[model samples]
Target chain A: MTLTGEFFAFMSLALVAVIGGVLLLNLTKVIHMVVALVFTFVSIAGIYVLLSAEFVAVVQVMIYSGAITIIMLFGIMLTRHHGEEAEPKGGGLRKLLLFLGVLGFGAAVYLGIYDLNFEAVPNTLHENNTEQIGISLYSQYIIPFELTSVILLVALVGAIVLARKDDEKEGDKE
Target chain B: MSSVPVSAFLALALILFCIGLYGALTKRNTVIVLISIELMLNAVNINLVTFSKYGVNPSITGQVFALFAIAVAAAEAAVGLAILIALYRNRRTVNIDEMNQLKN
Candidate 1:
């Protein structure tokens, strides 16, 4: 096997994503975990670029790293007094069980992938990735697209409803 | 030069999924658990995009699916955090372990 720029890029991005994920797991501070998650999201966007999914890459960066991360930070700030103080509960047996479960799942997936023979087809790239995506999204997968929009609208209303202070209603009554 | 094998992408996604799973299971903070769920969603996105690129058809369908997944994930995160905020307001705690009010 020969080394190439693509391989090197993939390796670097994978390292970033994996390390960021590990940090998100290990970090005690909620804010720090969000920052680490941002790193992972950004690197995943980079990987999308390598996959020639430029539109997805941009969306990943704009949505995941930009919008989602900001929303999480805001959630952390508005909800908690000191967002950095929460620590994992100390339970030796529970921790061991979780560790074992996660490990088993990972090992199973790794073995499954290893044993499966997948033909590596040469990736075909389109000149206009965004156009192709838009065409397919609107035409072939139109229903799901519309449903996703509805889901977002519901989420927006739900967030407002769920987070609004209940005392506001009582205050208005007075 | 051989293009980055599809297996590499699979491996990356698998690693990410496991990490997310571990965090979701072990972390006491509700915020971290939400973030872990996002990580897992991202891993799924990676898989979708990878298959789209290297699959027999090599179509844009996978990317479209990934887009929908991203949107849904964002919505889920928003609602999840909102719920967390409301829970914190009533309970004064964000630790999942202590969120046992409904348990009894």
Candidate 2:
């Protein structure tokens, strides 16, 4: 409500994030779009810090902005893009309709959250944020944490299998 | 953003999610579609962390949930990109509509 440093920080970060998303949508070059999204990802990290989730903010920086963006760029490089994605002529009508639909959905959600105020409870999440996450993750969330590792392993194996060149198929091609 | 209302954070998430949804639905490129999905997930993370700080029962749980979400999202992106590469190799195209075949 009142002018505060936190308010300015949030405003600037959110503005950059929104601008990055807009650029991602509007950019013609596929690589440029992904690059634009780095701004979004980093600003989201700033937002995370503003929300008093320092550990999550660091993770957002490391994982989302760092790792995921690199993987996306790799994905883009591996695939052959024709500069811009070709939208067929006359699909503008459908795009416009989709835009309107998305706008309507956003408006509906906005109305629900516009007056949604929660009384701020004092939480110890900020003090030793990383240690809090570690304790909780190793204690109450141990099972899910173990499950995540398993999931990552499965995804790793599956990706290799899917992306590996088919020797027999190549032989068949010859 | 201690002074900023919870609604503002929620609104930011909502806007990002909408942008992501629209991009995913309309983009022809498979990579961009996947990126859009990641953006949607990021928006969800914002909501989770927001509620963690400002909810009726604020605690560390919401942030823990967000960590799990990030892990899952990373795995999903890896698999999705792998699938995209494989599809590109077989089909020689990256457009989503062109990938509408079980067997050629």
- Name the best candidate (by lDDT): 2
List where candidate 2 sits over 4 angstroms from the true fold. A165-168, A171-174
TM-scores of chain B, in order: 0.95, 0.96
What lDDT tens digits, residue by residue, belong to model 2 across residues A45-67?
99999888999999999998899
Locate the minimum summed-lDDT window of 10 residues in model 2 chain A: A162-171
lDDT of 2 by residue, B1-104 (tens): 36899999999999899989999998889999999999999999999999999999998999999999999999999999989988898889999988988757
Superposed on the true interface residues, model 2 gives a C-alpha RMSD in angstroms of: 1.2
> Which digits, one per residue and each the tens of the lDDT, describe model 1 over residues A44-142?
999999888999999999999999899888877877646564544577888899899888888888987854435666555557999888778788988
How do the residues B11-69 of candidate 1 rate in per-residue lDDT, one tens digit apiece? 99999999998888887778878988999999999999988887656778899889999
Candidate 1 wrongly placed segments (more than 4 Å): A81-90, A115-117, A120-123, A169-174
Q: Report the CAPRI category for model 1.
A: medium
Best by DockQ: 2
Going through the candidates in order, state the TM-score of chain A alone for each one. Answer: 0.89, 0.95
Q: Give the CA lDDT, 0 to 100, for residue A87 in model 2.
A: 73
DockQ of structure 2:
0.81
Error of 2 at A23 (Å): 0.4
